[model samples]
Target: MTVNGWQVSGYTHLRELGSGASGRVVLATHDATGTPTAIKYLVGDVGADASFRNAFRGEAELLATIDDPNVARLYEYVESAQGAAIVMELVNGVSLRQMLRANGPTDPESALYVLKGSLLGLHAAHSRGVVHRDYKPENVLVTAEGTSKLADFGIAMPVGREAGSSVTGTPRYMAPEQWTGQAATPASDIYAATAVFYECLTGRPPFEGQGIIVLRDQHASAPIPTDPAPPPVHDLLRSGMAKRPEERPQPAAAFLDILEATAVAAYGPEWEERGRRRLAERAALLALLFPFNDPAGGGTAVAETVLTESSGFGGPGAGTAGLGAPRGRRLGGAQKALVGGGLVALLVAGGFGLSYASLEGDPVESSKDTDAPVVTDTPSAPVDPTTADPTPPLPPTPTSVPTATPPAPTASVGDTPTTPGRTPTPSRTPTRSPSPSPSTSPPPPPDVSPPKIGRSAASPTVIEPGTCPYGARSSTISATAEDDRTPVEKLRVRFTYTLNGATNTVSMFPSRSGVFHGVLGNLPYPKVITRIPVRVEALDAAGNVGAGTVIYVTLNNYCTPG
Candidate 1:
């Protein structure tokens, strides 16, 4: 099925995914059944090393024993004088590394779901007495359905892997014990899994550093980093990434129990479904990078602007991409755009609400998470435009409207000075007998009116190519809104927009001046001008909602920022 000197035998090659000095990985179809398979080859020096070949063969056999839905299946392992290759299931999805880069941080629900699937995969390996020593974001493949499959077990070793075995793993995700050259156990794998889970939730790994030694010291000494993630998972991170292996979750299933309970208590029962949907939407944004898109397409499984770790004990990065621990550059961060500390706005009366928190939509808000707000009136800088074109409701509230006579004419948004003076005459004429509430003195009918929103605008709708995902390249939405009973500052805003035929809900937080404002990013481009209809909705403290006008946003026909 292959030439004498071919890298792999018995499968036709479609394209190369990646390669290193040790070996190369390729997309191929099985000659017998034509099933898609990914074959990782060990060539030349490493392939011929007796120790490495034996290790590769042993792990391949261990992979064959794993039949869980979450772990990629190993089909066959072939060895010859030419080289050694392990054929595996070609996961038809992009890596988690790419997903975070394109869309930024995932919602809490989606992050939980991805972590759950990954833990399940790790559970399978752990149950079989195997440990995935390199469990980082790049090793987690997110399918179109948003489910994940753990891939690349090239460094996985059987439980109690000898201490003399070199300390090997992507340094960014290495466990404390791994840094100390200690034997790897299921708990070590759990530590790496937790670090990756943190990245999914907060858009960055727990620890990243410049060199392997710096990372090693941090892993051995740094307190677990979890504040950036939703609070519900803070305990989970602490338990899994505990500095000492004994302090971490013993088995992968034990961690799942804690994860499932926490997710339900914090996000409700439908959390997984909602999370998967959010993940699916974000993954779809990178459909072109999927290996199955075109077997012949020169596409790499990475985002347009690669995301990398800044500096921590364990961060996911550009290193150790393909299978095998080949001494890759495990320290380079992916340069992913940061998705925090941006402003937000809210939708008001008559329409749905939209508040901008971070560029990844609104800051994921939760009752337990008071640090970042979704739409509630959090005290921040003013964001709404005060482009003074007088609104229609102002003519009625003129300063000269207080009539001279004892006319208790109520002050309303639509009351004019001229009408207030005339209405006093009519009420007195009919009140010779004095009407219904003479004794009760009803405290002027309760404010039943909802808030009003006007002058909505989307600044710089037509953004230039290659300038986006940063300053001056993205669009900002601003609108004027006010309430009858609730202070305008207290109203919550939410904005909804359709992307790829699916409606996505975002937030528009208010500034200190009570104006709803938000910035819109993460939309794909390089196509002709398109019209996007954004829905607006607002909520006041009194539980009243009002409709707002739809705003249209456009994009350039061609050019995408790299």
Candidate 2:
């Protein structure tokens, strides 16, 4: 089947992992290497645009450069006339957002473990001068082994550069300076990371506001919540999320020392190990909700083991088949009680008074209600997709809107209404003034339009294979791009051709002429006739994208008969 207008080639589509406005992530196996991977692709108009493709390529390039264990790895990036795709390491685990939603409020040890891993990852990026502008739970992935790694560097920027004028990032976790449009620094990443650490400990973010404007204000001046965590961990949260960037740790690496010290002092030397175990357990639980096929075909078996061993719900014969069974026959009394108790613990742990929006789908929106907390009920055992019963509906989650209080207007000094120096007559009856109502303007809708990519062309479209028998073949490819509003941020060209029995690909960057130029050398000597494929893309500052035409260069070579 075709995905986002491109034919599925060189890989087998396994199952969909998740989807968002930008695109969908899917589980797939590479045909050549037989390795499973998570492939993210742009969709519809965004995929068709060149600007988004450029951004996608940029992300790929950044990922390819980083080699930290706590960061997701990049495998391949494919760009063609039809679309663009990124092949990345498929993390065999769930996002930290999903973990918190499944089991509210991690213990202090576990919270520290998560933070330490995240910090290490952020430090790796910082050391490379890359700042993850969008650091949050959703971007942190916890593998089955309980190792937490940072994912989704789509909006990452260099350390010294400002991301942009428009505010970008989740409202609740943004740093104070980020709200003020300052350049993203390692300190900002630490701030956002600490916000997530607070969520892990308290089951909710540190601050709550009715809307984006208020949320920004809260981050700027709201008191850091440390009561959720023990006294020992308070300093870490405070210093990491200090309102002033100067007050916080300078680089992300510096905070690691403090965190480890605090963790060791409070939870002992083995606190990290304990925390990772807890995370692994949580990840195991999440697998039941979002099941994906493993390239090795044993993912389901391992999941069943984790479920039965951890919850003590099902026995050997009581396989996941019962998950699709009728609701009444699915769970026994003891199993039901265990599941119910777990849910209650989650609720109690999450009773921090602040509301939390579900982090399952796209970035949390300011307008969405955050009243009813998300709960992961006891689901039936996961059945094979082919033979599985129709999945049961999850319980309805409640939404709550915070009541907004308008600010009291203050009278300016010496501006009180008075007739010269005459005393005002006392009123027969005093009237009580009503409190001014708060304005309830909704945040503006996000920009979703893909950037426009201009048509591209290649010079000397035809090349004789024998002409480069002992040398290289060179060609210049050029393309332009524009966005409806934002300026074109980047443009890239991917040149792919088959040499011998393997495929070779190269990425080309743009020059001063607003055109991407590259030289393709070491072309295979054509035995008879051959064709090479090439594609170009453009990206806008906002990450909206578009692509250009796919062209092929024909090479003709023939040996003259003696």
Instruction: State which candidate has the highest lDDT.
Output: 1
- The CA-based lDDT of model 1 is what? 0.58
Worst 10 residues of 1 by lDDT: 337-346
- lDDT string for model 1 (49-81, tens) is 667666666666676667677886665565555
RMSD of each: 21.6, 28.0
Per-candidate count of clashing residue pairs (backbone under 3 Å): 52, 15
Query: What is the per-residue lDDT of model 2 for residues 388-416, given as tens digits with 9 covering 90 to 100?
Result: 34457898998866559844334443445
- Quantify all predictions' global Cα lDDT against the true fold: 0.58, 0.57
Residue-level lDDT for 153 in candidate 2: 62
